[model samples]
Target: MNASPEDPLSQRPSRIRVDLDRLSHNLRSIRAHVGVPVMGIVKANAYGHGLVPVARHIQAQGVEQLGVAFLEEGIVLRQAGITLPILVMGGIFGRQAVQFIEHDLEVTVSSLDKLRQIEAAAEALGRKAVIHLKIDTGMERIGVHSYSAAPFIEAAVASRWCELKGIYSHLACADDPGSPMTLQQLERFQEACAHFERIGAPMPLRHLANSGGILHFPQTHLDMVRPGIMLYGVLPDPVSRRTVDVKPVLSLTSQVIYFKVVKAGNPVSYGATWAPTRNTRVVTVPIGYGDGYPRGLSSRGQVLIRGHAYPVVGRVCMDQFMVDIGDDSAWNEDEVVLIGEQGDAAITVESLAQAAGMSAYEVLVGLNLRIPREYRYS
Candidate 1:
């Protein structure tokens, strides 16, 4: 919404604003709280804030490491000249072994087959491949099960062409501070790590804490902690406590493109899902599901305009949506705050997610690359 003559606004009225200062604040807060190295998770396009920019900024903040969900995400960071220790947490295909080594990326060795693939690639190139052993304590999504991980750990520890840099496991219930499942998974992971000591092998760096763990479980903060949504100043769940002092780093805003008065009992937008009993002032915003604004927010969401909050009037369209302002005055091009503060009012990601009937993660990463992103510090 801050426009100038030289750096004018684009033809589109909606955009996502990223606060880099808030990101730095969150990183520092998490680091100080955990008292360990922080692997800033920038997966899913940095939670839809812009991948390259966010990673670049945080890397400059001197984060210890970085994590992503896919191989291509790491490759993209490398292409952008991000020279930092990046761990590709997803499973690796045999064909990607060479690419991973060439890019100087850390691989997640979830199984013996994956370890063999990396070893072969590294030996063929006469180079050492850095890897982390993944133990499946829970979240049956990936990694070798802790019950049967001894052989896999032994094989990885004996790999000649690979360097075992670290070992880790994903927490399935870390988001729920009261869930006993987290401690159970932690016990299983500790048991798996004990294998390294049992065989007289040095234990690699151990990391298991996630955002929820970072907030609630201090015991899980082993050698490092990976903070994803919390890094962006958003909680992973509705009941998540704000143990760390952090502010939102991203805000969504738009402008009123059209303004008109609707007749009494006349439906607005599609499907005639909502109408006012009396005539009212309505404004159209140039953003909708196409831009990742949830269609479920139709008539359920609220936006701040002219320092006042107004309800969405009807079904959200692909390219636009309607808002009822009643007798309040709002001219064309008036600033509209969708997920940010306007005067004394503010709309948060958690509230918006509740209105959309989606999780906080879905509300964030669901915002595709359709909307332009601008970065600021104030």
Candidate 2:
């Protein structure tokens, strides 16, 4: 790890280091591939990459718009002095409409009911609500059904208080090559676009390509693209194996707080689930379930020390876990990397997710807020 020139190792214990340089490269690369207005998705704390910092950095790169899953996330960006246009991917609820309008944030109207509520709120505020219509496409989650979309679009366009700025849909199976659902969704979205054009409704900014859709489909890149996971430097799916050549922006590092030796047949950690069949060098790390390292990782997980992979040898305790270094004397009170590169050997987020039986998205976002995040450009 590169330390600050002024004060090397000034404050070090446990931290998540974010590589701003890598983030910039990823954002630029994804934008080049999409060839359209790229809205950086910063929901779930920028998919656990630290929201405010990520947003500010991406915004500096000239990303015009941002998307978040909740209204509060938009507020956080606004509070952080981010003046870029932000859209709440999910629609605002009853009481949230006022807050959304107050901050000049855009809202996605997923349901007619949500549009009605937004209309009521807009009427009270005496301002037209800038809304995006989320079409069901094939996801069948929140969007209007394909067969009934025409009527819904007509109603929305006719509303006096609602200004439809965009018509968007989400891809459900773009990551899975075997799933033909994406093609169907694309056809449905194009159909909706055609309807809007035929009816003389302003062709709102049409966006349907998400990260997976942009990378896998390419043909679905409409007016705008939302890149979330790709911004964090990982392939969208296992099959694509067309590695996104982007650098990982997050590195998890911790110090060896203490160490000990266990005689043969001695057990370690809770439930005594792990036993040292032979004498072993045990190292304790100050990280556990509360810190976002999945509790389920217990004995199955691995950590890196001196560029070597070591087995996690016990039930991961609340705030600590044991690593059996196997009588190796190369380790002591030294820094260790639970996730990220260590020398030539490295542990990718994919490995951690596999060990914990989680998707790469979950692994990144699962990192709890308790862990301090340190941002660096070099």
Candidate 3:
């Protein structure tokens, strides 16, 4: 294994390196392709890419708005000096409505009660709360039902303290372009907007395209587009990757901190799940389920070292894991790649997700706060 005497990265066992240039490129590419304003999704710590830093980078790239799942996330961006428009996309409790106006964050009005609460808060605060009306076309998780959204829209449009800034719906199956449900949702959204026009309600900026919809359904790109995973250079599904041109922005890497020899028949890790048939070189990496590396990966995971792949031999511990590198004389401080290129070999997030029996979104967002994030550009 290649070793560096004075490499600073060798001091930390694991970290996530984020490529800002690629992130900016992806944002620009998506905007150019969609030809509309972009709302960069920065929820879940920017999907584990470091929320504030990623948001700052995206804001510098001239994105029109930022999206987060919680009101607290929007507050964080505002506290970090982000002045761009921020919309909290998740359903909110009525009590949290005041924070939206206080922080100048946009609210997602999912129900009439929530809208009334926001209006009340805005009136009491003497500030208008800008909002995006969320309609539930098929995804039953959040949003008002499309067929039942007329009153919601009318109330917001007529409210004196609420600014109806936009109307949107989540795409349930945009990853599968052939899925008829996407078309059905689109029809429902379009019809709902038409209803607003029929009643002479000022048509708010309409948006329905997410990363998947942006790639598979250009017609759904109304006034603005919200690109979440694609902004991080990951497609919502493998099939979408065939048509979307983007690059992965984050790489999980580590260094071998301990190495030893294990004798034949000796079991490894928590459950004694793996045993060596012969003498083997066992290298310990200081990362585990505690660091957001999936414990389910356990014996099924692989890591790249010195341009080759090695099997993880045991249950991934809370703060460390073991890899049997065979008899390869790999030593401490050797580079270990868990989700990035190593010489001619590489481990993509998709591969890691498959090994862990999880989705790519989970793999990315699940990366814990323990690992430091190193940012780079160019």
Candidate 4:
């Protein structure tokens, strides 16, 4: 069976299908387990799931808050009439503060210096900006130092121009079981929370869990959960060997541009990294590194055709690659899947990430906007 004839292009080839049903299922499962208000991290286009559609779907699934990485992303959601509470996870710098205040979006104040700048900006705009004081914990990337958190929290809470809506911290090693660093960071966050509560700093909502923390440590759930990859149905870490049995939502499919019978000893692809030792049927797919398929997948990548698994041959080029389709039912210049279900076989994003030496987040986020993302409800 194939796609409908009315929309030949949809059924024909060269499109990525988004499974909203799978997405909804994953959202429900995560919400049930996490047991807190989830701020669906839809930044980077919901990890390349198409921002507006995924955000709308997330809204439909009952998530009231959405998190993004930049001010522009939050603006886009606001323009789309999302109306839900959006927390800009990334710091807003320079003149972006006014836009954040105007849109009524919450932002993370990572540095006291940045907070000061924002306060000045809010005064200029004659509006109160809601901000969250971020604690560095052990990430060492952003946020105020745990020791200095007291003063920062006090200043923000007392600032008439700024509204201290919440306090948050990012976890650095929540995925690693033996990383005692998580415990140390948790203790620091707790102490900071206690300090805020004692001094009446008004840290109404406290959160510190990313996807890894939500899955591994229940105690860290606190008042909210910010999950990114897991909501899109990818495990936070592969080493833990946890499989959720949830369906993946994205399908990268293309077509076999051409088919050729190669004689023995004919080297394939650039650098001739792979050569045919025997007469083989080579199936060429029109998808490569240019489309976010990593070049590192060269000979390590796998694809499904007619319920059979075939190894990718040679180096993946910028726009094309060859697969060893072998002597199966004939293949022609038609739709072929490079990263999706083909009959009973499937190439999951996790498998592709492993083959490309990248994380699941990298694999999904690497998908360029040029690739058309088609969404379906069923």
Query: Per-model C-alpha lDDT, please?
Result: 0.93, 0.83, 0.90, 0.82
TM per prediction: 0.97, 0.94, 0.95, 0.94
Highest lDDT against the true fold, candidate: 1
TM-score of 1: 0.97
lDDT of 4 by residue, 162-185 (tens): 888788899898877557787788
Which pairs of residues collide in candidate 2? none
List model 3 lDDT by residue over 1-378, tens digit each. Answer: 112446554456688999999998898899889999999999999999999999999899899999999999999899999999999999999889898899999999999998899999999999999999999999999988999888888888899998889999999999877888898999999988887878987789999999889999988999999999988888787667445578899999999999999999999989888899999999999999988999988899999999999999889999999998996878788899999888999899888998999889999999987787788885
**Top TM-score model:** 1
Q: What is the lDDT of residue 248 in candidate 1?
A: 93
Candidate 2 lDDT over 334-367, as tens digits, reads 7779889998988888788888777888788888
* The 10-residue segment with the lowest total lDDT in model 3: 1-10
Q: Find the number of clashing residue pairs for candidate 1.
A: 0
lDDT of 2: 0.83
TM-score of 2: 0.94
